[model samples]
Target: MSAFGTLLWLEFRKQGTFAMGMLMVVAGWSLLLRQFFAWGAEPSIVALAVVASTLMLAGAVVTAYLLWLGLDFAREYRNGRWALLLGAPQPGWLHLSARLLFACGVLTLFAAGMWGTLAFWLGRVGLEWPLGLGLALWAYGLGGVALVVPVLFIGLLVAAYLPARADLLAFLVGLLGLGQLLEWSLRLFSAQFYRWLPPWGLPLPRLGEMAWEGFPGLPSEAFVLLVLLCVLLFSAMSRLWQEVEV
Candidate 1:
């Protein structure tokens, strides 16, 4: 396999088991919730439970996974594996991208799973689950979660270069600044001119022949800015990786 491919395989092997375990936990909880809903429990209540449980359980699991990945960059002492990888010919972007891509793939599966699980129970009650809108909303929420990978990674890179006792403080500062970067980027890009850009225009799931109006689909402008931000963050991360002392 090529170098990037090797990194991805290793990452998959290292983290795949955890991913599968978390998936099972999510699926198992979903099944239990489904049973509860089947017991003539209120659909509204059951749906709320599904949302809460999935967010608390699966969300934490994924957060922990990404935090672990990001924290690796901040370690003061090199493990044998880190030692070997740093010695390899790969660029820092390759390593970071491998992890980012894997996490994104896992996150997408998770978003889909959450939507599916919710839809499964919702369908039993003759409710219309808006597939397009539901998935888009999930993407928006979970995409925020995914954005944290670069933030944490970037924060830790700054921390690694700071005095030992000040590392946490530095990371906190970086976290605040990097977060504003996202917020301001959104503010800057969400201008009226941006509205002129093409929108995703995905169809809303019909509610039993009820017509809906004025539903703005996903904004292509925001999507463009997000992609640009990701590229900028990734480039910063790769540069900091080179400059950061192990």
Candidate 2:
């Protein structure tokens, strides 16, 4: 196999256990949420709203997974595994790209397992798959990706630049928590200002609201802007990785 293929395979191997654990968590959560809503007599608007809320929760799960993966990489760096991998005869960008691909692959699997479980439960409730469950799943998956890419990029940056793994993990948690606090403060105190601000201004609101109409969707210009942001962040992260001591 080619070098990139080999590295990609290695990345998958490293992540296998964690990925399985996450899949189990997603499955369990999906089943639990389904049971919570299934106690009702029939499907209602509230059920659809619950599905929407679940999608947002799924996005948070995916983001947390990505953060965990990035921190794992940082831990590997501290233990010299990352430097050993960098010693290989391949460009740094190729290695980073392979990691990105691995993340995308794992995320796709996660989304499938999560939405598939949800769909199964919806079917048990007599909902149509294509019209109701499938469409929502697709929207949720797309929105989740749109929400996760920038976070993954940020996590990569933290892992590459932060000298200590503990600091990297703490920074990730604080960053996410601060974003949520800011979003809540903004929404609570200044509704008009929140409406005027861009969709991506705060993480929680961005992830929660962007899946809806009148907010950023995967096909909209906002998504293109997010793609550009990811590219820029990834470039900066790659450069930092090259220059950092670890």
Q: Write the per-residue lDDT of candidate 1 for residues 22-75, one digit (tens) a residue.
A: 678668877787566766776555655665776677567767766765565445
lDDT of 1 at 181: 87
TM per candidate: 0.72, 0.59
- Count of clashes in candidate 1: 0
Tens digits of lDDT, candidate 2, 1-246: 998889888888888878788788877777577555656654644346556766777777777876686577668757977666645667667887887677777777776776676566655555533433444444445544444445544555565556666656756774796477446644554644334445432111212222334534223333444465567656765665565554
Q: Give the C-alpha lDDT of model 1.
A: 0.68
Candidate 2 vs. true structure, TM-score: 0.59
Worst lDDT run of 10 residues, candidate 2, spans: 201-210
